[model samples]
Target: MRLLPRLLIILFVIFAPLPAFAVNPDEMLSDPALEARARTLSAELRCMVCQNQSIDDSNADLAKDLRLLVRERITDGDSDDEVLNYIVSRYGEFVLLKPRFSVRTLLLWGAPVLLILAGGIALIVFARKRAGKPTGSKLTEDEKARLAELLEK
Candidate 1:
């Protein structure tokens, strides 16, 4: 019983920091509403340096810069959409963690499914071809006669 409690404590200590925010205290906004908006925007923006992590979760220098930029925009009285549009205009849509569904992004999203479907179709066709055919050449009449003569001998 004592061992279980100790193990739980150890696990908690090890995993607790994983979900902690990477935002520095110095960069935080004074207004709670603006700060909340900044935090939300940070979570939606991608860390360009880290590629896969959100700016709010990444410890990279670029991520820190982006977090500050978001706060600055919020403090300047920009609406959430304006902040997002400004960032998108500067960095292109690739800066957004969730890209808008448009023609370009649709191709990015659809390519994998299309490839998998194509591969599945190819596999089915190959399997059918293999199953339907017995790939052997028929012997000529002369070869059959020679085989019969040899067997009789």
Candidate 2:
């Protein structure tokens, strides 16, 4: 009887734990195609509660809601752009890893390269100015001779 109980306990532990990728079956799409779409869309969405995590990777309540939103939009026959735009409108562009390039964000897009070029030019100008310094003494031969004679004494 004691051995049977131990075996049962081992079986319960082995069967009870779920895999990391396991999702609630009700949340899964019956159609594999639609499920793929859900997975792809969810990966793009940021989890608001976990700023750096995608909705698909996060177990947060907000991530769950966002995942449900993606599936609902896909079921409604919305295009990917429409689904993404819906989230962007609610959360602002900060949710996107790669923000849209625009005139308002021109510096954000261009500043690093521009700053590097400017710094390179400034460094060259500084180096040239330093390099151009007179490489020899300006003193007359008489000064040199006097210094040499003093040293000899």
TM values, all candidates: 0.74, 0.66
CA displacement after TM-score superposition, residue 76 of candidate 1 (Å): 2.3
Residue-by-residue lDDT tens digits, candidate 2, 1-153: 799999999998998884364245677778899889888878777778888878887888888887888888889999888988998899987665566787867888899999999999999999999998988778799998999999999
Candidate 1 regions exceeding 4 Å error are: 1-8, 11-14, 135-153
| Candidate 2 positional error at 43, Å | 1.9
Q: Candidate 2: TM-score?
A: 0.66
Say which candidate scores most in lDDT.
1
TM-score of 1: 0.74
| Local distance difference test values of all predictions, in order | 0.93, 0.82
Error of 2 at 144 (Å): 5.1
The positional error of residue 130 in candidate 2, measured at the CA in angstroms, is 2.3
